[model samples]
Target: MTDYTSMANGGLPRISPYQAGKPIEEVQRELGLSEVIKLASNENPFGMSKKAVAKCAEALNSSHIYPDSNGYYLKQKLFEKFGYDPKTITLGDGSNELINLIFQTFINNKVNVVIPAYSFVVYPMEATVADAQVKTIPLKDWVIDLDAVYDAIDSNTRMVVLANPANPTGTAVNINKLKEFVKKVPHETLVVIDEAYNEYQKEEDFDDTAKWIAECPNLIVSRTFSKAYGLAGLRIGYMVSNEEIASLVNRLRAPFNVNAIALTAAIEALDDTDHLKMVVAENAKERDRYVKYCEDHNLYMIPSQANFVSIDFKRDAFPIYDALLHRGVIVRPLKGYKLDTILRISIGTHVENTKLFKALDEILKSLK
Candidate 1:
């Protein structure tokens, strides 16, 4: 047999794959636990909207038919909501695929992508696979340093990816600061704002990148149905940008990239305002409760506008993470993001949160 390693692109050789949270069934199998509460992945605990569920069921009956290549109905709904032309929208399997498509469209061996040192890892990983150099700007107080990012940009910089309410940290840049930063960036460089958690933000002053897209021709705002809409399993996300940029990205996107059921469900999800409000309210209450719990326990935690909170253990988080898992509570350790002392916990139902707190209390007591 031929050595396929040699046949592959040498520069793109051996990339580390993303480690998603362990499934409940897998954990139950491994630990022999009956009940498991997953406070990982920042998923909506309430599950998907009823309207979306109904729409998905209707679409599933015709699952044999191929999905619309253009995602016409979904795009129309999005157009009404955001008032952007259908030409400006490009749907993806998820926002992650949209991220890769952006890189594939513009990035090459010569161009480099700039990302925050502690921002989403996908940007750097995808850039590496494209054989493009990656410039990582260190975080300031667990938040993205817009000034530092601007300083890092040079002539070879092709794209800059910012995850507002960034993962693992859950910090966000306000509207004014983001606008100033956007104004300073070179027009030739594409600024991709990944707003996957946009629905969870309670801040009145949050950056509205969608409005800025009209002014900044180089800006792309990507949103996902995974978080607030409770459609993570369906894997539907879309990008809004200028027609020219969207056209470039569309060229690289596969036909029927989004599935038929996902498209129908996402359209219905958009109309489910009551479900969205309930999710936002529940998440807010749980987030505040978690923050208070951390405070009472004297655990340091980053202030978050997103659904998850990054709690500092003041020690290696992996051990505590393992302890929590053994207690049937699953949370994410941020060791991969260089914050070994922090664990990111997604907000869950009241009972689930209480169980997690109880587990943490027991583990901490044992450690002491």
Candidate 2:
């Protein structure tokens, strides 16, 4: 038989597949439970806008036709809502696809990539597949150390990745400091800010970094409807860069990469600011509950701007995770990220959170 593993790219064989959060049905089937609450994936617990859902349902009739190859109307909606130039927008299945496109476009063995530790796993995964040396910088005080990241960049560094309101840790970098850091990076090096959870941030802390693309042509901002817009199931997202870079990525992007239903849902979702406001507001309200629970229990919860909070249990947390599973409550374990003592829990609805707290109380008491 042929040695298929040897035939693969240098880094492809070494990469571990991404582990998504456990689903409700999977837990129900395995545990023989009738009810399950999932607080693992950082999804909008409130769910998608009714208007977007209706639009998607209507769009199903036209699914046989291909999606707009250019994502024209969605780009127009983005331009109207946020003033993102349509010429500079590249739609993808999700921001995940855009991140991969960026790595495929710019990374190679001769170049390197710089990212803070505990970044969205895709950054390093894509860079590795492109055979680039990944320079992982340690976070300072649970936040990205911009100075350290900047210092790590060299002439061969092709890209620098930052995830505002970072995942797993649920910490965000100072926006002004991030801008200054971007300005300091060399023009030849691309700076990618993955704003996957941008909408969950407080208004005072939010900065639309897409506005900086004209000034910093090498800057690329990727965002998703999967979180605040509650369109994760549809898998729609887009990136903003200079027209030249966008055109380059577009050349390589598969036609109709974003499906018809997703395009329609995103357009409607973007216009439904009322629904967006409700989702973000509820996320903020529930996120505070997690903070208080951590404080009352003496577990340190990382201050988060995203829809999730990572609690440091200060001991191996796998047992707690397994216990929660048995109780029909699913949260994420960070062992894959080498964070054995921390569990990242997505802020769910009030009822769901209450169930988690009750289950957790029982589990913690049993330990005593």
Candidate 3:
């Protein structure tokens, strides 16, 4: 019998596939529910900007033509809006793809990769696929221990990964401290910071890491329109680094890597500042409600600057997660991440959140 698994790349066969949050339609079909609200994937509760949506529709007319291979217009938009250097930018299908590209470009079995615990999961996964040695650093009080991560790096370390307002835990590192860490890292090791939830952070906590690219040539910053910009389905993102790194990653990027509609929508999305502001403001308001809910219920809600909250049940939470699912409220269970006692729930609109609270109240009563 043919053994295809043995022929697979490094750790591909040994690793489990990424389990994304279930779509509303899939839950409806599986459970025979008429209505379901998904608070699993940390997507923007508000849909895409009206301007972006309109642009996407208009772009449908050009579907037959290939998108600009280099995404020139979108790069120009980023440069105009954020003062990013177009030469330092590399377009990606999503920040996930850029992460993979980084590992593929630099990582090898002889080198090691440093990552903090409770990260985005893609970090270690991509490193493993690249056949790199993985170094997992422990968190300090539920947040990434930057100092520990620094100590883990050695000459053989090829990369260090961090996610600001990190996933699952929703805890972020102080920006000033992060800058210091980046400066101290050796020039030989690449520092990758995934800021997918950057827009959701408070104004006081935000700082543009891309500005440091010139000073720290080994630094790479990746961001996406998936969360705050509300373009998850379009899968548009970009990476910022020195021109040398950008050029290397570009060589591996597929032509027309970004589709025409995504490019159009992303360009418009960057321009619609009002819509982005509303999404961030509403997310802040609703996120507070989740904090209070946890406090009132005697649960611990991790401090989150992102658009989601992770509550520690202090015991296996699968039962509670299942109950919520049956009641037409879908939230993330962290069993796969080995954080079985915690569940991460995305902030939704007011009405949706109210419905979730009501359903949760009923479920809690039944459990007691």
Model 1 TM-score is 0.98
Q: Candidate 1's residue-wise lDDT over 1-368, tens digit each?
A: 99887677625675788889889998999999999989999898999889888878888999999999999998899888878789999999989999989988988889989999888878888888888888989888888999999999999999999998899788887768889888779999989999999888866747568779778888999999998888889898999999999999999999889999999989988998999999999999989998899899999889898989999999998999999999999999888887899999999988999899999999999999
Stretches of candidate 1 off by over 4 Å are none
Over 4 Å off in model 3, which ranges?
none
- TM accuracy, model 3: 0.99
Tens digits of lDDT, candidate 2, 227-258: 99998888989999999999989988988899
List TM-scores for all candidates, in order: 0.98, 0.99, 0.99
Residue 358 lDDT, candidate 3, scale 0-100: 91
Clash pairs of candidate 2?
none
RMSD of each: 1.2, 0.8, 0.8
Q: Clashing residue pairs in candidate 3, if any?
A: none
Model 2 ranges with Cα > 4 A deviation: none
lDDT of 1 at 103: 86
Please, what are the lDDT tens digits per residue for candidate 3 over residues 13-80? 76789999989999899999999999999998899999999989889998999999999999999999
Candidate 3: lDDT of 154?
Answer: 95
